[model samples]
Structure formats: structure tokens, C-alpha cells
Target chain A: MKTDVSSRVVDKGQKQSHFTANLGSRYTIDRIFKYAAWGATGVSILILVWLLVTIVADGIGTLNWNFITSFPSRRAENAGIIAALVGTVWVMCLVALFTVPLGVGAGIFLEEFAEDNWFTRLVEINIGNLAGVPSIIYGLLGLAVFARIMQPITGGRSVLSGSLTLSLLILPVVIVSTREALRAIPNSLRLAGYALGATRWQVIWSHVLPAAVPGILTGVILALSRAIGETAPLIAVGAAVFISFLPEGLQSQFTAMPIQIYNWVGRPQEEFHYIAASGIIVLMAMLLVMNGVAVYLRNHFQKDF
Target chain B: MTDNVTGDIAPGSWSPKRDRAKAIQTIVKIIFGSFAAISILTTIGILATLIFETIEFFKEVPISQFLTDTRWTPLFASKQFGIFVLVSATMMISVISIMVALPLGLLSAICLSEYATPRIRRILKPMLEILAGVPTVVYGYFALLTVTPFLQIFLPDLQGFNALSAGLVLGIMITPMVASLSEDALYAVPRSLKDGAYALGATKRETVTSVVLPAALSGIVSSLILATSRAVGETMIVTLAAGANPTLGFNPFVPVMTMTAFIVQITKGDAPYGTIEYKTLYAVGMTLFIMTFALNIFSFWFVRRFREKYD
Candidate 1:
């Protein structure tokens, strides 16, 4: 009986040591993991900070009123982004004009009017697929359809073609966001309108649209910001790199800020790289303003249930 | 009864204003319906454009030669149309990017979902999104002018336009996307499961690795696939930094041209419409489109098939 008791005591001691060892190692592993994750997060933030600081430091000296106003030149020092800037504005305006109506209408139809069916499902799937398609592929589509086939109407790789391509590119984003915004409104509002003998269209126009406007506007602004930064599609649509004059109309050939920046970056000169950095600053500033407005709209006007 | 009380309309008679409003509603529905159909039209346009041009391209270059040949020198006098050269380069860069992005993105996602407080998440999420919102052209500039130069200091043999720099920057560009999607997935893991793990005397890391990660596997895989698709379709960074040389091997140090980069090169140059050279762009694009489309479809399918249901 004495020998059996001693053996049991020895077994208990071994179990205790093993448990403590496992606990210590587990804690150590957890600590190591925590530090590793923090390190990853730090690396991402560092990269962003480094990128912005580099661009800003390199370009701040060259940024001036003339840099924004003058035309492209053969001399790197004299060259400016006036043509590209104006072209971007022109394209963005047209893109907005085309995208908002079509995208919102589609969203309203799918969310409000259309019944659950295979066709609606197909469209949803198609839009999802299109969103994942590369921007360069859209550029190819624009080249074939808007630029080549519809040349008589689009004037062949003009601002109109670029705008149309970007409109298509961002159309999915707008439609998806609009649907989400519309979906967020309580169904009780629609039912109340109907109970008051309101037509569907009347209910949508008088009650639903006003409530969803802030949300839809925010989405549109974000989508436009994305469209503004697109370079591959613009390049594929044949945006000029060295247009000296500003775009006169939708039909006029043009260059955009990104395409211009791309042109400058591609050149084998140090001065052009600095100028490209300046152009990027302007583009990023525009995006920042747009995104700021979007945030404000979301936070300031968002309503709770 | 209401009509009789108002004395404005007969019970059985059609009111002109009501008829007009009804007609307007029908017309409005048609307009909206047609607007929705535009997306369908876009898909059709892409398919039709690619198919027509691709068919034309195949007529000039045999399918076997296009697939089997090792050289892609259609622009030169000795015309060889092997697509493997470009595809190999594209795959090499994509693999390099995936290597950099997957681990970094997943770990950051874990930290955000499991460790960060709500306020910290709010701040960090937007900061990461800002990284995503930076334009691709800017990234290309950074890659060519800054990243390559910096990388050369460590590896002296790195070319001015090497795949390593382009892939590395592309990885950075896509990290936010992977993190955001994966965080959503990890956050969706049922709290009850995590609580059970804690009750069972499991550490946070053990619970996450054994239970949470397993449940969120489908979503994580889909996000990875989507990121891969993005890398495959990336154009500007590859074009600007990865040089125009279409090589057949997997060397990150040398200059390589991706499929998208080739399209950009052709588009930027004077490959006039209807020429064999111009047709080759569509051919390469068709290949690229098929690859991305397959990946996207697979991602969707995987999510639908394997997602863990908590309810």
C-alpha cells in the first residue's frame, strides 16, 4: 500500500510539470503571433507613408499656378498638365452624366420593380463578373466598340470614348451601391405610401428617392473617384500623351491626368519624373476631396432605424 | 364611392389623368428595364469583340503553334507566335505577388478581426482603404523609380525593369483587398464557437488557428482567388516596371512582359486596325479574359459550396 501511494504521487508530479510546460509554450507562441501580426500591420502603414512622402517631397517644388495652367511642351521644364487636367474634368463630367441615371435606374428596377427571377439573377451574376474583369479588358472593349465600330458617333478615341469606357467600368459599382442604399430604407415607408393610395412610381419619387439620396450620392462620388484614377482603360482607349491643346468638346481627342502621368513616368528623364509626381499630387488631391465629401455625406446624413 | 363623393370620375369610366399616369409608369418601367439591360449588353459586347477578333487571329496563326511555340516575336521579321513565353512571365510575377501578399494580408486580417478594438479598427480600416485607393499609375511610378532602385542595393544584379519590383509593388497594392475581405470572413466566424474554445482552456491563437480559421476557410480562399485575379489582370504596374521583354522562364531578376503589358504595348504603338499584329492583341486578351473569368467563377462557386452556416 505504501509503494502504490508513492508511485501515484510520482505520476501526479510528472503531470503537473507537463501541464506547466505546455502552458508556458502556448503563451509564448501566442505572444510571438501577436507581435508578428502587429509587424505586418506596421509594414503596410509604413509603405503607404513612404509612398506619399516620396511623391509629395519630390513634387512640391515644381507645383505652381503655371504648372496647372500651361500646356504641354517639348522642354520638360516648360511642360504642364493643363491639357490632361482639363481632359480629366471633361471625361469625369460626362462619366457622371451617363453613369448616374443608368446605374440608379437599373438599381431601382432591380431592387424595387423587378421580381425574383432567372433574368435578374443572371444580371446580378453578370455584374459581379464584370466588376472583377480587368480595366484593360474594358479598354479593349472600348477600342473595338466605341472607338472603332461607333467611330462616327464617338469621334474615335475622343473624350466621349474615354468617358463611355469609364462609365461602363464604374457602372457596376454604382448599381451595387444604389441597390444597397435602396434596400436599407424600411419597407414600412413603401407600404404607408401604398396605403395612402399612392402609385408605385409616386411612392418611389416622393418618398423613397429622397431618403436614399445621401447614400446614393456617396456611392456615386466614390465611384467617380475610382473612375478618375483609371489609367489603363484611358490608355487602351487611345488617350494622347502629348496633346498641346485642351479638349474642346466630347468629340475632341484628349489626355487625362493618369495618362499624362504615365507618359511622364515612362520617359527616361529625371525632370519628367518630378513633373509626374506633381501631376499625381493634383490627382490625389482631387480624390481626397471627393472621398472627404463622401465621408461627410455618410456620417452627416445617415439615418438610424 | 370615393369617386362619386368627389364627383370627378365615374365608377366605370376611365379618367384621362389616371390613364396618362398608368402609361407613364409603364414607360418608366421600360426605361429602367432597358437601363438594367445595358450591363448585359456590355458582357455581350466584350464576348463578341473578343470572339470575332480571336477567330481572325487563329486563322493566321495555327492554334498548335500559338500554344506550343516558345517564342512570341510577332512584331519581328522571324514571326513566332508561342503564347507560353508571355504566359510564363505573367504566372511568375503573379506567383511572386501572391507569395508576398497572402501571408501579410492574412496576418493583418487576423489582427484586425481578433485583437483590435472597435475604435482602432475604425481608424486602421480606413487607413488600409486609403492604400487601396491610391492609383495604379502612381504605384507604377513608385515601382520603377523608387522600389527597383532600392531593391538593387540589396541585389546588385537586379535589372532596371525587373519583375521582382513590379510584383512586390503589386503585392502591396492588393494587400488591402485581401485583408478587408478576409477580415470580413474572420469576423463572421460565430462568436459562440470562439467562446467554446476559450471555455475549453484554449489560447487565443489556438482557437483562431483550429476553429475560427477552419470555419472561415472558404471565404479566405475566395478572397485569395479574387486577389490572384486582380494580379493577373494588372496592367499599368507591369507595363511600366516589368520591361517589355517576353521571356520563357521564371526569373524575378530579369525583365519580363506580362500579357496585360503586351496589350498595353500594342495599344500604345501603331498596331493599325485589322492587321495580324493588331489581331494578336485580341488573342492575348482573350487568353487573359478566360483566365480571370475562370478564377472569378471558381471563387463564387467555392463560397456557395463550402461556406459554414452558423444559424
Candidate 2:
């Protein structure tokens, strides 16, 4: 009986050896294709490099102070981005003002007060769906609602109308991110706050907001950057591409960096194309700066938590 | 836990501090509730605007003609409002973009998940995010001014403004999105399954193919669906490179206007606020909105259906 058992164990060991199965073309193909995956990443990097190179080559000369300070002109050399720059800043500020409070408050409610029931689940799902809605569609809503329906209030395609549209566009993203930020806090913090005499609002105000600030700030910056680059929706809502003056208030007509770049790219003149390249460089720089702030805040908070 | 609080909360009397706290709590609750309703209100507003305008547009132009006709010349002296012309163009670009995004995206994701070292992953992930963050308008500019010109050199017959360049660049924009989502899916596959494959003397490739890929199949599929939705709704790239011609054809070499481009075209000109021409935008928006809305729902549902829990 011992001899028979030993023979059976030896047979099992032989059957389970690492090289029991012969290597074949399938394995070879997969091994070879691993490099193809790396190659795919390389190709993406190449295209990015090429895009940056092409625009930088064309646009470098147009990045001087005069380019930023001068007003729009029939002459490409004389036209500056003062109006577009001002309009972009105005719109971003208004978007920040409108989106932050509502987004953060909604996030707090969803994380703390929501019952985790079907109604709250539906709301969560609805927010996700809204984030995917095309910006151009938002433009249509803005056109109908802000530009026309609320004409008396928005003053018809002024910065107010444009800002409100952008606010609505970014609100979903803000809410989602803020929820993520708020959710990162430990439940013990809430329980401890309640262990004292603190009300729910007081606990959240004192304990949660400080902890979530960095994450919320990161999300807000990214959302604002997205709003900054948006052009199609603004186009839909009647942003003039060639505005040469600043928006004095919320109701004034405005032009943004993207709209300006878009118009310059479309002009028949070669110089305008070069100018468009410069505008692109500026836009890209602003994007990088915003992203930088977000990264810094994220790192600082991550180190804390 | 509640007994002390209940005993402290006497029926008919309150201190000034408690009264203030109660009032503040009531106000805060109302504020938060209203803030939460903003999202719902946004959805309602979008639907109402689109539907109201679309209903008015259909009263003038029949739905059957809008869907079935072959031409879409809304602003011409003689009008033929065929929605298929735009739908086909949108489909053609969407299909081309998917073809470009899928292989590149999936391969990169597989490579990152299955092969790359942690250091490599950290480096590659940020590069991908940077790629993703480059704005669509910038991509549009590159597609029009750079990619189109480069493609014309090889395919000499390619139009100055054609679907191929726009589709290709849009694919580039979408690849990182696909890679990130798919990588998360692949990462979620349990390690024990992979170890089991190894224990059974399977090669790494064999293990991934038969074990991991199948395990992550629904996630991969949902990523594809989400990518498709993104391509369908993309605007600036197509607007800049795909030309404004609303031609009815499948040729990626020729200039064709997508539904998004049509909306941009009409809105840029702002035909006349209440004209049928103006209301045509809402009809187009309705179609675009419906397409994206349905795709997003399907994506979420597909993901939930295949959700896996591992010990």
C-alpha cells in the first residue's frame, strides 16, 4: 500500500510540472504584442509632442506684451487679446461664485443627510448622467432659458447668460467631486461630533469642511478650467468672437480666449493662424497653471490625511 | 444613545442658545435641500427646452421625413430636412474614432495593468491624464491645421476638411479616457484567479486571456460604450476639421457635417431666434441629447450588472 501511494504521488508531481505544456505561437504572439502596447503609448506621446511643437513653432513670436494688451483690429499684428482675456476672467469668476457654494452644499447633503434610499440613488444617477450631456446642448438650454426666457434677467447673451450656462454645465462635475471629497472623511469624526452636544450642521461645519477643502479646491479648479476652454456652448449662446472691449458688468457682451482663438483660426489670413497659435499657447499655459494649483493642493492634503 | 437627548429636549420650553441652534439647523437643512435640487432642475430645464422646441419643429417638419430623408439642407432656399444625412455623418466619424480608440486604448490598458512596473505606471498614468486634459478645441486646431495637411500628403485625394483627420484626433482625445477606465476594470480582477492560473501551469498570456480578460469583460465593454458616447457628442474637433458640408455619404475622405456641427453652424449665425431654422437646432439637440442620454444609462447599467466582489 505504501509503494502504491508513492507511485501515485510521483505521477501527480510529473503531471503538474511547470513545463508540462509546450509553449506555442499564442504565447509568442502575446509576448511580442506587449511591446505593441508600449508602442501605442509612445505614439500618443509622439502626437502630443508634434502638436506642441507645431503650435509653438508658429506661435512663439506672437507672445509678447503688445499681443496681450492691444485691442482687436483689421490688422492681425495690432489685434490683442485684452477683451478675450478680460471676458475669460469675468466668466471664470462668475462660474466659481455660482458653482462652489451650491455644489459644495449639495455634496454635503448627499453625503451626510441622504438616506441611501432609492430616491437619493436616483439623484446620484441623475447627476452622473448630467455630467455626460454635451456642452452644446447646454448652450441650447442657455439660449432658450437664459438668453430668451430669462431675457429680462440675463440681459440677452450678456456675460450673465454665458456665466449661468457655464455654471450649469460644471455644476454636475462639482457636485460629484465634492461628494468624493466629503466622503473621504472618517465616520468616526461625525460620530464623535455627535457624542458631544454638536448639531449635525455644526459638526459638518467645524469638522468636515476643513478636511474636505483641499479635495474640493482641486475639483473646483479643474471644473473651472473646463469651463474656460469651452467654446461651442458659448457660440450657441451668442458669444461674439470678435469683441474688442471688456464686459463692464454681468450683462455686457463678451468674448473668451477660446472664442477668440476659434475666430482667428477661421480667418482667411495666415497671420491670424499664427495669432491663433499664440492664443492656444496662452490657453494651454492657463490650463497648466490651474492644474498645477490643483496638484499642489491635492499633495498637501494627501500628506495631511 | 438617544435617551439623554430626548430627555434634554423638554416639550414646551427652550433656552436662547438652543432656539438659535434650532433655527440655524432648520435654515441649513432648507439651504442644502435647495442646493441638491439644482441638479434635478437642470435636467428638467434641458428636457423642457429640447422637447418644447422639438415639438414645435415637428409641427412644421414631419418626424418621418426628418428620419428617413437623405438630404439635410435646412437653410437653403428649397429645404429638405432629412436627419439621416447628419446621423450617417455622425456615425461614420463615431465608427472611425472607435476603431482608432479601441485597439490603442485597450492595448495600452492591458500593458499598463499586466506588465508595467509600479514606477512605470505612475509615470504613464500622469502622461495619459495630461493627454486627456488637453482641451478639445486645441485638438480641433491640431486636426485642422496639422493632421489634415499631413494626411493629405499620403492620401492625396483627401479633402482639406474631411472626417478622417477629425475622427483620428478625436480618437486620440478619447484613448486616455478608455485606458484609465479599462485599467481600473483590469486592476479589479482578483489576484487569486491569476495565481490559480499560474498554479495550473498556465503562461502569463494564457492566464490573462482566459482568466482576467473574461473577468473584466463587462467593464471593458462599458468603457467602449462610454467612449462611443463621447465621440458621438464631440463638437469642436468635428466643427473645425470635418467641414460644414452636410453631405450624405460614408466616405471619410470627404468633408461632412455632423449634427453637432449643424447646431454650431445655426447658432453661430443665430438665423433668427424663433424661426423654424432656429427651432431646427432644438430638434437636432433633442436627437443628440437622446443618443448620449441612452448611451450613458446603458453604460451605468452594464457596469452594475457585472459588478464583482472578491475576497
Candidate 3:
């Protein structure tokens, strides 16, 4: 007790304390933590750069006109992605055609038209759940339904099946993004349309939809990009990885860039690996273009809002 | 008042144009309403297809042996229908990926949310998210060709087709999900909490480590859980880089087959439609669906439940 009191008296008397905040390792710890945080961010960026550099370095050699124009071959030098490229374009176009109207219409209904009721809420919640379901599950659904259950329409594992599978895989994304775009429009803008003697449908079509076009287009492009990159669903729908011809029609069998890339990556040859990298380069270019446009659209519209 | 205003516009004027407008509105509403039903119809289709095909699959492979057996050699002569061979592989890859992602993602989130200036974060956030945009198949080849070779230089025994490499690339792929999510969580933590820590003479490190982390723990955990589910559902990366050999082991260095890969594998070949072999695809998908659905619901619940609370 005496020592404690004497120590307290000494501490009170002293102008400087021995155990100060900056007098020890506290500052060092703080700086270290800050640097560690920065380092972690750097590490992720570094990895992305490394992966990109490696892909470009290995794949750029194979990404010539010949590669894009020629068909797949057993010989690595002769192998190309002409068929896969065409199939991917066809699938993307069909996927975009199918998803945009349906997805955007659904988003419009749920956001602007649907009443605040249990059924609307259920649809909303189910959309969220569907967004979380794996792409492969959608593939199985496509296989069972489009390819088999609706055989005549889908032609059982044709381009139609592939595109439908991909559309389902990306439908939730499109709907969610569309809703976001729609939600960005203020309620006052919507109310003004109504106040101007416009019906709900008229208001949505003339004011709400037009104002939100940029955002909606951005969302739609992003969804299409996701669909284009998808492989499993297409594979499950029986996309041929070795096709040498373009899809002649919606009922024609097709292959896509990702499946081709996956096929090459699974091969034992070192050359095929390089070919796989080239396919990835093309796929990445497509994705980047799509995402870039989406980003541009979003930024362009966000300023006014 | 409303009736008076309407009477002023046009008393009892139900013109042909007005009638046509009403009809068009109803048609438009009906069309969009049906569009909305497509999602519900899609869900029913998925569930019905899975259930119907899974029932057929179960008749061929008994549920008991399928669950209890240790082997999963469907293409082999023996034909052991064990599900765990794929389950364990999926788990092993997911575990490795989570191990890689949680730390890196959390740290990156902390950096972006707490440490970096808003200006820096604005640039860094999108840059990190770009990782997510790269297709999984691209990542698969990147893993098989680039990452595996890079790792083989260190662990010479690491197989060319190993879970570690694929999982590592997958970890990189999903890092944005974790970082973006956890950053939102950390950002939601009331600034007052950090101020209190500062008033107590806590350093910046201490304020973040003690005050902020506990507050945002649930969001970080949920993000990690969601990332794990993503890794589980990932197909091409595992299918290409992780090998098709469905071994019942947990070694990260060896080749392992995932359920997604197995489904893709059988369906890629000439498995006759409605046959037992083809039905296996649906069976595997059912398992994958249930696993991911549970994880997603848990993640959703966790995010909703324990997010930061303020007056």
C-alpha cells in the first residue's frame, strides 16, 4: 500500500511519463498495420497483373488472323477458334435477345407496377435465390427441359439449348441490375409523369424507361458479358468443344470460346496449353469490351442522376 | 376533391382514344406480368427436373450405398456410386480457397475501407473487381499453365493437375467478392466506435483491430462463406486444372474431381438421354444445388442478422 501511494505521488509529480503512447512500439505497429493493409491490396493487384501478363505473353503469339479465321486442328499451330468464335457470337446475340426483354420487363413490373403484396415479395425473394444458384444447376435444368423436355424447339443440345441455358444463368443478374437501374430514377420523376395525365404504362414507357436507358443498357451488357463467359451451362447443354464449322442455324450444334479454352487446357500437350491461353485472350478481350462499355454507360448516366 | 378535379378535366368524357389507352395499358401490364412469371417458372423447372431425374438416378444407385460408400467410379467397371469422392474434393478445394481468400480479402478490405484515402479507394475498388470479370475458364488455363508451373518450381512434387493451384487461382477470382462485401461491412461500422477508441488513446492499428473488426466480424464471415460457395460451384477451373480423377482424399497437392466437374464430364460425353449414366448428372447437380443453396441462405441470413447496429 505504501509503495503504491509513493508511486502514485511520484507519477503525479513527474512531468513526463515513461509509458507514453509514441514512446514505445505503438507507432511502429500502426505503420506496420497500415503498410500491411496496403501490401495486401498491392498483392491482389500484382496477381491480376501477373496473370494478365502471363496470358498475353503466352497467348499473343497465337492470336493472329489465321488463329481467328482457321478452324480447330489436332496440330497446335493449325488449331484456331473460328467455329468457337462464331458460336460465341451467335449465343451472345440470342442470349441478349432472350434476356433483355424478359429480364427488363420483369424488372419493370417488379419495381414500378407490382403492388406491395406477398406474391411480389415472393418473386423478389426467389430472384435473389436464383441469383445465388450455381450456373451448373441451370445447365442441368437446360439439359432436362430445353434439350429433352422441349426437344423439338431446342433440338436437343443445339445452339438454341446453349443460348437458353446461358440466358437462364444470367437472367437473375440482368433482372437485379435492371431493377437497380430503375430504382435509381427518383420517385418524384415518376410522380410527375403521373401528374401530367400519363397512365402508369405511359409514364413508364415515356419517362421512366427513357431516363433509365443508359443504366438499363449498362446492366444488359454486363449480363450478356456474364453469359458469354459462361462455360458449364453450355457444356452441360452439350456444346461440342471440337466443332470445326459455324452454327448454320439455331438448331445447329455449337461450341463456344470458353469450352474451347477448357478443352485445350485439359490436353496433355504444352502447345495446346498455349492455344488455350490464346482462346482466353480472345474471351478476355470480349469481356473487357463489354464491361468497358457498361462502365462507360454507367458513368455517363450517373452524372445527371 | 378528386372527383371535382376529374370533372373539370372532362365531365363524363369516355372517348375512344381513352378506351384504347386503357386497353393498351392492360395488355402491356399483362405482358410484363407474364415476363415476371418466367423467373418463377424457371425455378419450378429447375426443381422439378432435378427431383424427377434424381429419383431415376436413385433407382439405379441405391441411396444408402451412394451416401456411405467411399468410392465414386461411375465410368469404371466396378461402378462405385459414392458421392463423397467428389464431395471431399469439392470441400478440399473450397477449404483451400477460403484459406487463401479470407485473409487476403479481409486485409484488402481493411486497406480499402479503413486505411486508404477515398480517392485511392475509388481507383483500387474497380481494379480489384476486375479480377472478378475475368472468366473462370481463363482462370482455369491460367492455373494449369501459369500458376501450376510457378508452384511446381517451389514444391517439385506438386502434380501438374492439383487442387492447390486451381484453388489458389479461384481464391484470386473470388477475392473481389470478399473484399467488396467485407469493406461494405467495415464501412458500415459507426465512426463513433473508432472515435471512442481514439479518445482512449488507442492507435490507428488498435482502433481498427479491436474496435472495427469485432463490429464487422459477421459480414466478413458471411463473405468468406459466400466465397466458399462460389469456389464450390466453380466448374472449369476444377474441371481443367484439378483433374478428372475423383479420388477420396484431401491432399491439396493431388488431382481431385469436383461435383461440378463430374456433372460436366458425364454430360459432355455420349451419355444417352434418360439413361442411368445421364441421370447421374442431375443427381450430382441436385447435391451441388442443395449445398450452395444452404450456404447462400446462411450467408444471406448472417449478413442480415449481425450487421453493425447504431442508434
Off by over 4 Å in 1: A1-21, B1-17
Winner of 1 and 2 under lDDT: 1
CAPRI quality band, candidate 3 = medium
Error of model 2, residue B250, in angstroms: 0.3
Candidate 3 chain B weakest ten by summed lDDT = B11-20
Candidate 2 residue spans exceeding 4 A from truth: A1-20, A24-27, A303-305, B1-16
Off-target runs (Cα >4 Å) in candidate 3 are: A1-23, A302-305, B1-16
Candidate order by DockQ, decreasing, is 1, 3, 2
Candidate 3 lDDT over B262-301, as tens digits, reads 9988988878886778888888889999999999999989
Residue-wise lDDT of candidate 3 within A1-305, one digit each (tens)? 11122122222344476663342466567777878888989999999999899999999988899998999999999999999999999999999999999999989989888998887888898898898888988988888889888988878889999898888888888888889988989889888977877788888998889988898899899889988888888898889978888999999999999989888888888898888888888889988998999989888766465
TM-score of predicted structure 1: 0.96
RMSD of each: 4.9, 5.5, 4.8
TM-score order of candidates, top first: 1, 3, 2
* TM-score of candidate 2 against the unseen true structure: 0.93
Candidate 1 lDDT by residue in tens digits, B1-311: 44554466446564335556667878888999899999999999999999999999999999999999999998899999999999998898888888888988999999899888888888889999999999999999999999999999999999999999999999999999999999999999989999999999787889999999999999999999999999999999999999999889999999999999999998987678999988999999999999999999999999999999998
- Second chain alone, TM-score for each candidate: 0.96, 0.93, 0.93
- Compose the digit string of candidate 2's lDDT tens values, residues B1-311: 44555568779464335556768987987898789888989999999999999999999999999989889999888899998899899999999999988988998898899888898989888888888998888899899999999998899999989999999999999999899999999999999999999898676777887898889988999999999999999999999999999999999999999999999999888567779988899999999999988998899899898866677
lDDT of 2 by residue, A35-131 (tens): 7888887887788889999999989998889998987778999888889999999999999999999999888888887778876777787898898
What 10-residue stretch in candidate 2 chain B is worst by lDDT? B12-21
Ranking by lDDT: 1, 2, 3
Docking class of 2: medium
